[model samples]
Target: MSFAKWIGGALGWSFGGPIGAIIGLAIGSLIDGTAQQGGFLLGDGQTSRKQSRGTHNKRPNYGKQTQRSQTQSGDFEVSLLILASVVIKADGIQDQKELDFVRQQFVSMYGKERANHAFRLFKNISQQQIPTRKVCMQIKQMMDHSSRLQLVHFLFGIAKSDGIVVEVEVKQIYTICGYLGISSRDYESIKAMFYNSSDNAYKILEITKSASVDEIKKAYRKMAKKYHPDKVIHLGKEHQQGAEEKFRQVQKAYEQLQKERGF
Candidate 1:
């Protein structure tokens, strides 16, 4: 597929806000003799003008009754690119292993052709200075809870790709988690997956060692439900592998607790 078609068709709510601006800048740098210069594809498959005219002013409606719009694959893809850049540069050095991990993961999830297109965009994105708070706040507003959790999981995966997740990378991710409105508990739960600790299982389950058997079971059930692969089914099968990995980690954590507790 053409780069324009791939980007134009893949995004939805992400085609607006801070995320959109980041993407716009990336596309501007990448667009050359091959692609159209005057317009690009919007999520709806329409040709947008030089700017995303109608969308720049649009804000996510916030309320108890207002529901977040579903996150499309393109939205998730672009978000991942931007955040991965943030984590990779957190230590002031871009490790090749981390960059390879990003490419490999995209290839596994999106196939070779699409992965190439994504990497091209990612290269451009990595060169720019991103506003982490504004980008993350837009994501928190536009994306659903499960999708946002999935994002955190992926960011941790990116940070850990280089064998060891550096302290700076961890700090960057923690800041992102806060900006994304992920609670400390949920952040710790996902963070536990990438590190080894004596109480990692408890942390993965969002519980403490002092908890009773009943609480262990309860936390397991809650975590299982929260990390279920089905939660991100709307993003298509490409994402199920990562979601399943998270779900399996939750199960393993619960099982470890079960073996230790002997109940």
Candidate 2:
């Protein structure tokens, strides 16, 4: 119900996001009272003029978290919540299944109690008119390529929870991928797991529409190594199954292409 639940490490919402311009505050713990601070704002509520003027006079120790390990999980959690909210809303209707899917993901990382609490904040996140660019920019700043790829995979699962990945969701995902700096091949590789279309083969192998036979062969070998299900075993069986699906697609696409091109 508060920005407190949305983030941990005491990184106040007001201090975490760009200030002066922030009109809302569900996660409003700004940096002592600076316009440069960005927070994990919860609702439209914002720091009043009095609070922004440094009534507390004490700043959070964002400086203490100089190492990546200290903030990786925190960053991933907040980023996932923001991006998932957009995917859930892509179809113009928020389905219960989509929400449950997201909660399941949280439950895997956090225990049941914490997952439920995060879900409540996620509901708040879903309703907010978040500046997609700004929030994602912060996330992009915190996460690396591996982290970003996992984010896209997790989102793909949510969009497919209702047994269909709608067009709007796909479009929104493409935009988010752009913001997250996910390569087109990487995006399509994940997308193939949920929605396979005419171009899926190229996507599976991370090739191009105009790829030649030799190029396709090389891409297949490379993709096989890259997406080997064993690579994601630590992510648990559920994620392993998803990885398996993608792995199978890469193989199937390879065989199909071989036949199509008489290779």
Candidate 3:
């Protein structure tokens, strides 16, 4: 079943607190009066749940996950909606550039059909008040390290949509990472991709500005190897595409440095 259908079942309950009601309103607003017109997109999700349950029951014993993680993984789309909402609001207002960046990413991954539902979910999510740290804590507990890392990566991309990551945005990502039990350095590395300044190319390549040309080239090569989308191919096509975004940044930084230093 599509992730969209899986999300409707948990929309009102998963978030909890004031935001839970807010999220319910969000979904309700998008889905209102349209059920008769387009019910499939806003399915009650009973079929999706039954299908998922059946699939879980059939999983080999050795590969089975506890019900807890399964529940968490099932909420992946909802979590992204919430987390992306928080990031868009981090700078005190919703910026079109950020929203468009996120929208384009969703469209790229889910295609026009599903991306419409996703964009609606995201659009609605943008209108609510998010409890950033609490939700981050929940995400930390439910999601694995790799998934969290990718979430932060997407957040950074939104933060940088305006050409530079402002202080508040950076602070927000750092705070979320802290709550997520992720290392600050990992956030820093992702941050480098979006915000470039005087010597940012060097930073992106993880090399010193004063380093020898040979050393810079070596650093670029190493970064390319490390960030290649292939490194994350196991995560799924969407993630592989997102990784490609980071990989492109690495390539661009290297090329810019190469031009400046005549490498």
Candidate 4:
């Protein structure tokens, strides 16, 4: 397999995780010659770079894109970075609120320091343009079924990072997901996970260490009914798999509580 395929597969497995991503791309420099130009990095404040022929609004540039192929590791990162930058800045101006949100994701994916590096690199890549459609097609070819789903989830997470979703960002992600062969149902599954994870964790397994065993049981029962993977099986095999994964998490959380309290 090529480096791009290896990295994509690794990243798809981790999904929004940085360590695995960095590890996957460890064969060479994460930042390539195409990515080493002057541009606003993740935390480098809002600034523009040199634009392509049609790209008027100036931003930074890691030089000009000589070639564009999502199959190339550099190109793939460039595409993702561009996608992320566009999503975060879709609201007219890129602000600290949005940057902070992306930063937090960086920390989650690669830890604070490495994620910082990723942030910088991503910012640089975003300022430049590669063949978007060609790269998207290449990405679709390499990213497998489950990996594509995870990509949609990452896109959703990025959109949801700032607590408000831009219509453009939403449409862009939807389009990209479509390009990757992700069904509407798959898109919805990821979107629901993003919106639901923040507030839904509590509802999934109601358990406070201080709460009595009765409360725990009640919460589990309610969650079991609500999150039963079987309930959404009609959605299709992909959805059933997703729901099953979620159900496993629910089961694990409940089991942990049971063990802690000796219930």
Candidate 5:
């Protein structure tokens, strides 16, 4: 008989005669065997006890699932474009400097073809409704705090492309950084570094206030070559703009040091 019927009859036979007891015993044994085959057992079944108490043999798909989670959504597409627009407009001029930077950054991180497509996609998204936090949350979920902070730095780099970051761009970047959950101090630190990085670059290149004329020229050339936009052209147009701007500032720093030192 089936397990359900057996259970019902067995319970009903609590006060039945010996014949009822025998039938119940046989049915209970049959039900117990079936339960064991299906990963269960009666109270005293050794196989059930062992299986229940033993470690699971199944290997989890954690890595696969984690990778899947990382690429689960396409939510960053719009936000990245929005931020790109913000950075490009930061200097009040959407010149080659800003465009080149955006291109190179995307290309390095996402590949040239992908970067080109992304820029085009960004343009399209710019025309549409800017998505709300609900959409951005999906992208944020995929990124850890460090990655978010890095993204903010990239934004800052773009913002500083044209030598001067416009107030609108600064406010937009601050808002974007806030949405990304980056602390204000961290964002300010990143921005401050950008603002003062020409000096830092000069210091690193050993172009001091007392540097000679030839020394300043040599330093400027070295700095220009190091940050040359041509090297990152493979990153595409958007990225080249930023790198070009950086190279320009490198040249500017060298000139400033020269002027101060009467080079």
Candidate 6:
């Protein structure tokens, strides 16, 4: 499919906010040759024909009061592209490894054709100055909690792709977690997945080593429910592999705890 049609059909609520603006700029450079064909692009970077009618005249509602709708795979894809760019640049160096990781992950989740389209947009997005907080807040407002968690998981994968998650990258992801309304516990839970420490298992379970076996078991069940691949099933099967990775980590942590305590 054409890039314009893929974007036009894939996005939902994201076609109307700061994300929309970023996507608008990226597509501006991408589709200049096809501009006259009147694909998704319109005046001033507007992507949606329906939104341009009445919503375009009014200011975007970025407030917490705005009602969130079901997040589409395209919305998740766009958000991932923008945030991946932010995390990759957090350390002041755009390591090719990190870029390759992004491409590889996209190829794994989306087929080569779609991944190419996404990477093309990603390159354009990387050149601009993104207002990270605004973009994240928009995502926090519009995206479901499960999908948001998936985003954090994928980001940690990117930061770790270079073989070491730098301090700056950690701090950047932490700040993003805050803006995305992810709790400190949730942040640490996902963060532990990419690191090795004596207490990583506990962190993954969102608990402490001091907890009794019953508590550990309880935490395991809760976490298993939270990270289950089905939680993000609405996002489609392409995303299930990532969510399943998280779920497996939780099981590993629990099993490790069980063996240690012999319970």
Best by lDDT: 6
Clashing pairs in 3: none
Per-residue CA lDDT of candidate 2, range 31-137, in tens?
A: 22222334332211232222233321333333343222222333445567778988899888999999988888777656676576557657766777767776655
Name the TM-score of candidate 3. Answer: 0.68
Winner on TM-score between 1 and 3 is: 1
Model 4, CA-based lDDT: 0.49
Q: How do all models score by TM-score?
A: 0.87, 0.64, 0.68, 0.47, 0.43, 0.89
Error of 2 at 12 (Å): 12
Clashing residue pairs in all predictions, respectively, total 0, 24, 0, 7, 15, 0
CA lDDT of each prediction against the hidden true structure: 0.82, 0.63, 0.66, 0.49, 0.49, 0.84
Give the TM-score (vs. native) of candidate 1: 0.87
lDDT of 1: 0.82
**In candidate 4, how many clashes are counted?**
7
Query: What CA RMSD would you report for each candidate?
Result: 4.5, 9.5, 6.1, 14.4, 22.8, 4.4
Q: TM-score rank, highest first?
A: 6, 1, 3, 2, 4, 5
Which pairs, if any, clash in model 1? Answer: none
Candidate that beats the other on lDDT, 1 or 4, i.e. the better one: 1
> Model 6 off-target regions past 4 Å?
1-5, 32-60
Regarding lDDT, does 5 or 6 come out ahead? 6
User: Over the stretch 1-263, how does candidate 3's per-residue lDDT look in tens digits?
Assistant: 44344444423224443334555678786554345444333223564355354343232222233233443322455677788888778778888888888778877875676667777777777777777876776666655665676788888888888676788888888888998888765676677776657877777777777989889878878878777776654434655777777788878888898899896
lDDT of 4 at 168: 82
Please tell me which predicted candidate would have the highest TM-score against the true structure: 6
lDDT of 1 at 236: 72
